[model samples]
Target: MRADAGAILRIDELTVSFRTDSGEVPAVRGVSFELAAGEALALVGESGSGKSTVALAALGLLGGTARVSGSIAIGDIAVVGAGERELQRVRGKLASMVFQEPATALDPLMRVGDQIAEVIRNHDDVSAAEAQARAVELLGHVGLPEPASRVRSFPFQLSGGQRQRVVIAMAIANRPKLLIADEPTTALDVTVQAEILDLLRRLAAENDMGVLLVTHNMGVVADFADRVAVMTDGRLVEEGPVDEVLLRPQHEYTRALLSAVPRLSVAERPAAAGAAGAAGPAAPAAPARERYVEASGVSVSFGRGVRAVHALRDVSLDVAAGETVGLVGESGSGKSTIARAVLGLIEPDSGSVRVFGEELRRARGRRLRQLRAGIGVVLQDPVASLDARLSVAECIAEPLLVHARGLGRAERRRRVAEALEAVRLPAAFMDRAPRELSGGQRQRVSLARALVLSPRLLVADEPTSALDVSVQRTVLDVITELQRELGFACIFVSHDLAVVQEFAQRVVVMRAGAVVETGPTAVTLSHPETEYTRRLLAAVPVPDPVVQRGRRLAAAGGAA
Candidate 1:
């Protein structure tokens, strides 16, 4: 149907292609949808399915080589071929976009309140002082704590959730008619994600704003959107209300996408043979296998005295050879800090971290180097972690040269090739630059580099959080396969509870720098002992519209 007077966003037969070196490549094809005022429409798909392209095209944000066809309208503004001046007027006034990564969306140097005020000042004929006050008001409106005090703080000072709130405040500073959110809560903690979704829902209702949510997360789509549009291979495969679409998907691609979503498989785990009357089953006893590393009462603090941040508080963790321990937590939950401690990167203020029976805090010089050489680190965002100047071969070989400098060039090349093969990548990728590959490919290269040294332990930090469900599955599969052959222990740190469930045999839940719960993945997630763990599990939105609706209804009833 064509957009009527009440429609806030309308797109008809919109097709977009880019002029790549390989010639015209279609990103979006014959997509049409209408979003009414105060209604949220989610465009859901995997990577390269053109969901983001559609959102960007609505604001004419595509680059120079992008060839656009058909039409896109935000309110009465024609966005298809609009001039920069017209686009600018429409940007903050008619429509605004909240990108996925809050860090890149915000200005690191300027105070967040000033940034919000700048957007307000740009569109409205208001004084700087007035705009600043409005920014503070926006901050409070977005549920940010102590808005008045935080207004003067730079983006760096705020937490991830706070930074996202600042971005939302800026997006709605002008009260735009349409809000385009592309993967707004990709890597956020479960509770933070729920808060952001509720905030967006509340803001939309209060301001009568329509939201165009672009994401691959089925759970987010289930919780936030009124309607769902599924895209595949640059085409609209399915479109319906959230209930109808997600509850009973009509398209196979939609079904696959929903199926690909990692869900919390909570089951009725029968109590142990002799422990029927206990409060709950205890964490599994330590196995008698080869223990690779053990962290005992590990406490870490940054800064000193009153201003100090306690990143880890007497946190203890252990991993045996051929084991994968998932470290799950929110931001500032000591998960990453503990992982770094395990890697010998951080000297703990108290307690001890012993890897291969050697104390990490005391290891120095050659000892430290030797210990580090046995530990491999894989961080999130391969694009930033990888060196742009180096080819895949060099990137993978650099570790070998650093640890085993006596190895001949031929042996180094063979090791790199074997690593690539283990990760199921072609040997030809060795000569390619980091930028010359896709997100998953870059990540594979990163994995190859981490395993090139054949380290006994791997600390993978949010390694698959940024990837699509399919790509994430592939990476996890590769890791599993390699772990079987290589027999390396892994400390996988992630805020992605679903992925933690999928990849790790054991789960360690952290909160406020303390380990709240530790047990098998199923036991910890399904029957968590701590209220914090229960809250964490409850905050996770399963990829089912019916279940989500029931949860919302139950929550509303409880609130009432």
Candidate 2:
């Protein structure tokens, strides 16, 4: 493709390949595109579709094993065949890249301010104090609150949204002409996602920079990008204006993807709303049998004396068999603590926990192990949870090996295959290592591992949050199907109300380490009583136009 008049970045016939044991894996297949100055183009595709590879290749960030063949021009310089030194000269000064997971991209051990300042020092001979001041200003520009104080904190000390903002601060520290953001909003809550998108838009507009946004979220691309490119199986299948792509998609893959996204506009809700009138499902009746897990008057305090902070205060709840319960809260709301307590991984200072009507808080050794064996957990980030060295089959077989040792080798293999199939994974993946799979595939493997033992209860903490929309839908479907087939209960924990709405029959609203409200999903959502639950429901993504219209109509009605 030729440059569109005056283009900041242009690539013609770019192809990228990696040498694998099976053969050469063609990642990007002769893809050609152009990004004019101040233009925002979205690279939309599912996992393993080569969207990220294209972005990585443009900045000359591909691995040594990758073979590239094409012409890439950034500004007036050619980067396709540039030497390491030449590329380094162009990297931060000409174009910068911001990865999806800011926590992983930023140095956890270093203060965030130092990391951003280092970028400036790498390009310019600047004093540490000057670079530090510039870093603080950059952080402020990215919409982070208290940027000065936050700059001194480590990556772990900031929220996911704030961490992403810091990463943006680092990316734009050198004021590059082009910024490549790869799935910047993945795994964030809807409220935080909107804020981050807004920040990116403002930054790109203010700098007059070309932005290459790589994501699978149609909502984001439709609302933000000027143009869109659809990729499939390492090939660009469609390219056009964002509206044309979203409203009138030509490619079958794009159509399938658009159809998969769940919309809240016409979603089914419960017969009654919660106290706050937030849309939710009707509450289901609690099971009559003894509670499988119960916590009473739970309180957890951190630190000591003046520094002592109460993370959980008088939190109480119960989970019954054959039921799915949702724990809803924002980050650091102590929902994870609740999960940990149920798993016997944490002990509350002043509370009683009972499993199957037996005291579990005091249980130790054999009894604790037995209780834990009946429960399973799927964490938010699968890459961190999975063992990179183990093959997919080996990972799935671990739970079975622990309990059913008497089973023959063939039987164990057969069970592993069945578990994999349950999660809709291809059988060929059994031989592949965790590193070989994409983010979504690794999550499926985690689900397979958890389900192999046929546990009665599953603790899924944002299980599909890190995946693309297509992958999220598929993963949720697998979990629902497995739950129905095996008659296993689930404790769905997430900040995404939309996802939890689909999974749980009941919902529990948690804030500041306390259960503010609990009721049937339909009833509570349709009519949320607590202000926190209402805020959470309102924070869900509605188009800006729709929000404005709703406000206007409400104002008119109020006046009438």
Candidate 3:
């Protein structure tokens, strides 16, 4: 391994395995690659591929159940057989890794400044004050809005995209030779994801570091990677330049993965209404039908007397039996508050909430349970929503078991199996724990659980926010298909206008807990009546080719 002029990191015949219940599971099978100074390489594969395992190996972060073989050289240092102490010394200086989940990776209790300062203090001989200054500088480098103010904030206070930027700042604090980003953009919206990828590229160029990007998105690979290595069942099946690999894949699995990517055609891209042809005026008012869920003069207030804070004010909306309505707004816009009120989790201070022509506030005990059971809710974070220790079957079956106790063991298993298949998971996976499944797979399982009871209404709160682009598409497709088949009313909530544009038929824009505007999705997106809506749409990052190419190079296995 050369340090000054050429290769920064070199892996020769690396093999990694884990101790599973069934026996030993070899995750990285004879993987080898060279990462040069200021280069990028992408490791791409499906959920079970060895991409993540290889990253852990590179960082010497593999746990007690894992074993490694062969040589991994980083800047003239052999990390393959290095002890814990030695690895720690090299970790921040030579190599750093940005994790998949920003929420879990960051410490919730610690202030953002302290975390970044800790990384600086550990790897470099810097005074506490100097380290703190470095932390602020790092945050600025990552494009945070206000580093000074944000430094005092906790992890929970920031958005998902903001937290990811914090993590990136920490990873690059010591200016490591190699930066391994494992699905760095998986949890972010497409627009935010693009920004993050661009930031990573600029950082890599500025620091003259190699980057190893691991992801499941073909569009990401095609757009960003300098070179791509395709993995299947822990084996490196194919390796080549990005264009050669994605546009003309030699491997069957690679081709399958490429083909699976959902692309929007020019026709599919919605045209500007007035620019093309003005949309026809709304039809003449007709006799109003009975609303399935309705809210009138809805207002919620907290505290007593002068201290009270109004969360929602004069909110009004309706969803027919088969209508899919979208609630779009920034954070703290009372979207979730309205949802809670409708679900009977909270009582509004004023106004009425009706479901099936019955008041939700008056509903109690069995009535509330029956109503809730019929209206399923899918939360943003699947891991938080589900019990990690439970098997898929148990998680899905718990609702059925509690509500419908008459069903015997066989019937329970049958229903559970049917639900699992409906979400496109194999029956064999039903026995596996949630930890074993990928983020997308776990989300599908959550959807399956929600759909098991044949609920008449579903409330999804940023359901696809924490998924890869490919996975997001799949989840959205499944939801749309099921919506058409079941004709169930739904309340789709998200900050991403692109996702909402794809899913929702009708759109409701909210701000500071008040409805800003309401109309068809096209009308709201294309001809936004309010300035807030225009700003929201304007903030969305278009898929730029230069940004994509930069991301691809940084993500690939640093093969420059």
Identify the leading candidate in terms of TM-score. Answer: 1
Give one digit per residue, the lDDT tens place, for model 3 in 265-320: 21123323323234545634434554678999899988889988788999998988
lDDT of 1: 0.87
- Alpha-carbon runs more than 4 Å astray in model 2: 1-5, 266-290, 405-410, 425-432, 542-560
TM agreement with the true structure for every prediction: 0.94, 0.89, 0.82
RMSD of every prediction? 3.1, 3.9, 5.4
- Any idea what lDDT model 3 has? 0.80
| Runs with alpha carbons beyond 4 Å of true place in candidate 1 | 1-6, 267-287
Model 2 accuracy (lDDT, Cα): 0.82
What lDDT would each prediction earn against the true structure? 0.87, 0.82, 0.80
1 against 2, candidate with superior TM-score: 1
How large an RMSD does model 3 have? 5.4
- Least accurate 10 contiguous residues by lDDT in model 2: 266-275
TM-score preference between candidates 1 and 3, better one: 1
